[model samples]
Target: MELTPRLAGMVALLAFLPVVAFGVFRTWWAGAITLVNVVIIAVSLYLLMSPTESEAHAAHGDDVESAGDEAL
Candidate 1:
């Protein structure tokens, strides 16, 4: 099944909800959920930190001076 970004984020959060609930209720699943959440958060952060190809190109081009003066 094709998953949209919103759906994926929801699924990620939902996956931890049970554990959070269990932890709040003082059940054995507290640590398990915390660990899972940590892993998911780490992965999310990694994805966010990674740059796209266009961003890299723009960064490289940004320092190039314009040639408008040559047209005069």
Candidate 2:
């Protein structure tokens, strides 16, 4: 089955929730470390998957330098 972004997110949440929950219940330090690790992983994944600013402009046929200069 193809893993769409939404599905992937759900899968990741499911996979982490149990371990994090267990850690949290066991001790403060474990909970903090696990939570921080999860946040870092999620952010890294997001940055890697998202398109760069130039790529987004190119995809929409917009001039990269002029993207923010349009009149409101």
Candidate 3:
């Protein structure tokens, strides 16, 4: 399955909304669960939004391969 960046970000924010509301309402247990949910959402958002190291490596791998070829 695929999600657009904007949709993913919005989902992340929505996932945290209940926690924020629970905290404001002083519902401790619900707030705690919400906080956990928020953390999970945050990590998911970061992972989704950030570029993977593999992509960088792939981009630079050609240069490294060319250098090795020159040395041969």
- Model 3 ranges with Cα > 4 A deviation: 1-18, 64-72
Q: Residues 1-68, candidate 2: write the lDDT tens digits.
A: 86554555555566477667768679877777877777677666656655688777667756656666
Best by lDDT: 3
Model 1 misplacement above 4 A: 1-27, 57-72
lDDT of 3 by residue, 2-45 (tens): 67655676777776676777777987887888788777876788
The Cα local distance difference test for each model comes to 0.62, 0.66, 0.73
Q: Give the TM-scores of the predictions, in the order they appear.
A: 0.38, 0.57, 0.55
| Candidate 1 weakest ten by summed lDDT | 62-71
Candidate 1, residue 14: lDDT: 61
lDDT of candidate 1 over 1-72, digit per residue (tens): 756555555556665665666667786666676857766875695566566776776666544353343235
TM-score of 1: 0.38
Two-way lDDT contest, 2 vs 3, winner: 3
Lowest lDDT sum, 10 consecutive residues, model 3, at: 62-71
Superposed by TM-score, candidate 3 places the C-alpha of residue 7 at a distance from the truth, in angstroms, of 13
Candidate 1: clashing pairs of residues: none
